[model samples]
Target: MTLDPSVVTAFTPTGKLRASINLGNPVLAKRDPVSGEPCGVSVDLARAFAERLSVDLELVAFDTAGKSVEAVSDERADIGFFAVDPLRAQAISFTAPYVLIEGFYLVRDDSPITRNQDVDQPHNRVAVGKGSAYDLFLTREIKTAQIVRAPTSPAVVQTFIEQNLEVAAGVKQQLESDASRFSGLRLLDERFMVIQQAMGTPKSRGLAAATALQRFVEAMKTSGFVSAALERHGIAGASVAPAA
Candidate 1:
């Protein structure tokens, strides 16, 4: 069967950021529980991208971020619309970040590991998604925590809620949300790895498309359009750092 046109554009109905956004995080994807339609910050941003492109908006949904990246790699989607890291950059070309985010550590609010440094102490069993940025950051930068890979944030929460683990790391936004679900848990100190949230295109796609998207995203940044989109979705604080 012919590839759906959305596949060619990385799930964007139009081949531009303004026309669409697709994501792997369903919590953020904002699905209509009844119609199962895609909705959320990612979808809204994609719509903004389409509007900037002067095209119609469309969003394709994926259940997980990893699968969203796979869609881009396999030409089924245009972008994953989430945090970008070095490994992902190697796998897919990315535009300059439109939002700056930080990774975080979460634990029971009453846990003794109150500071970021405490997590590094011996036998501190920290849970994190197997292939997630939290895993990468903790394994590489956070030398103190003994990592117990959980494969997904919810899974980590499951174990933590059962008192099976002490500390865990994940995206601050996701972790904070999970913390709300469990009364005992809360996000710890602001220890976070500053990351730029960017869009992706297949690596095989030449520099032209990637560069063009980057430039367009930058222009949107300067024009304050991106900020408007973020506020529209209640993500007011997600943006690039102001000039030094």
Candidate 2:
């Protein structure tokens, strides 16, 4: 796909396509165990987008979603992979999601939080990754429970365990992995929310560039690129989003 010159310029103002990668989201990105380089579905998408624009790819890596979103909003990076939230949309133009991931709640096996609804009690302190999708969502939806934030998404379970919090909130796959490492932890049977993971550019990039990105995401979803990347990276518990 040939992108317009203006669109290319918008995404490559620094002469390279800088993609803000959040290594905290294991499903979308992670450090290679051996190489320690960022690799996963989001990395593949960033590379493909850079190639489409015919620019060199520069990964601006961050350990948290908040930092990644900040990079794009501040124009330190041209694009980023992020969970779509209304608060984030104020500064970034997001495409329709390319992947859908479930947000689940975790608790000790002996904990009384048997259902998703049981999590909102006033006495329950829920641990979540600060500035993560779960954090953003729960900050609004959780009426009575108090939210305690960990440094990053991967730290939520640890924070919950350490602080004796009543619940932990995060990605289903991530929570499952964490549960396996510790004893007596279990996930609630039902998910609390579905996170829409999408690609975004700074709204300052203009309507044309934003529209081009939206089209690119739709094409990626329709052509099996997103699905293939998920499988190639051995990502489970997440699915390719339907075409927008």
Candidate 3:
């Protein structure tokens, strides 16, 4: 793919393409248990983008999506992987989502809320990661239940357990992993939301860069690169998003 020179400049101002890797979204990026390096579908995508640009790949790691968004907004990173959230769109321009991950609620096995619909009630506190897609979504959609913000997505499970929250909202895979690690935690079978994971560049990067990224992402999805990366990384519970 021949990229416009300006697009390259917009995405690699420091001569290296710094991609923000948010470990908070475990489905997208995670720490390799053996190597302690960032690894996952998002990491693979970032590496692929860098190679396509013929630039060095720099992983700018963060613990939360908000921080990753902030990095791109601040021009500290060239691109970031994010769940398409309207609140975040002001600072960054996003490609159509390349992956879809479900968002679910985790509640105690013995809790009264057995169904997803039971989560919303007066006095029911839902623990969520502050500035997360779910947090932003729930902040708007949830009319009755109160939301308690955790420091990060990975921290939500612990916050739920420690604080005895009525519901814990996060990525389904994450809640499943947490349920296995912590007994008595059960995820609602029904999902409340689908997270649209996409790549983003600072809006200030200009239209050329944005268009280039969108094309790159769609091509990656259409050609099966994103699916291959997910399988290679053993990622579960996420599907390749259809073309925009």
Which candidate leads in TM-score? Answer: 2
Q: Indicate the residue-level lDDT of 181 in model 1.
A: 75
Q: Model 1 — TM-score against the truth?
A: 0.78
Instruction: Compose the digit string of candidate 3's lDDT tens values, residues 20-127.
Output: 999998888989999999998999999999999999999999999888889998999999999998888998999999999999999888888888788889979999
Q: Where does candidate 3 stray beyond 4 Å? A: none
What's the TM for model 3? 0.97
Query: How well does candidate 1 score on lDDT at residue 219?
Result: 69
Candidate 2 per-residue lDDT over residues 79-162, each given as its tens digit: 999999999999999999999999999999999889999999999999999899989999999999899999999999999989
Model 2 lDDT on a 0 to 1 scale? 0.95
Worst 10 residues of 3 by lDDT: 178-187
Q: How many residue pairs of model 1 clash at the backbone?
A: 12
Shift in Å, residue 62, candidate 1 = 1.8
Lowest lDDT 10-residue stretch of candidate 1: 18-27
Candidate 3 local distance difference test against the native? 0.92
Clashes of each: 12, 0, 0
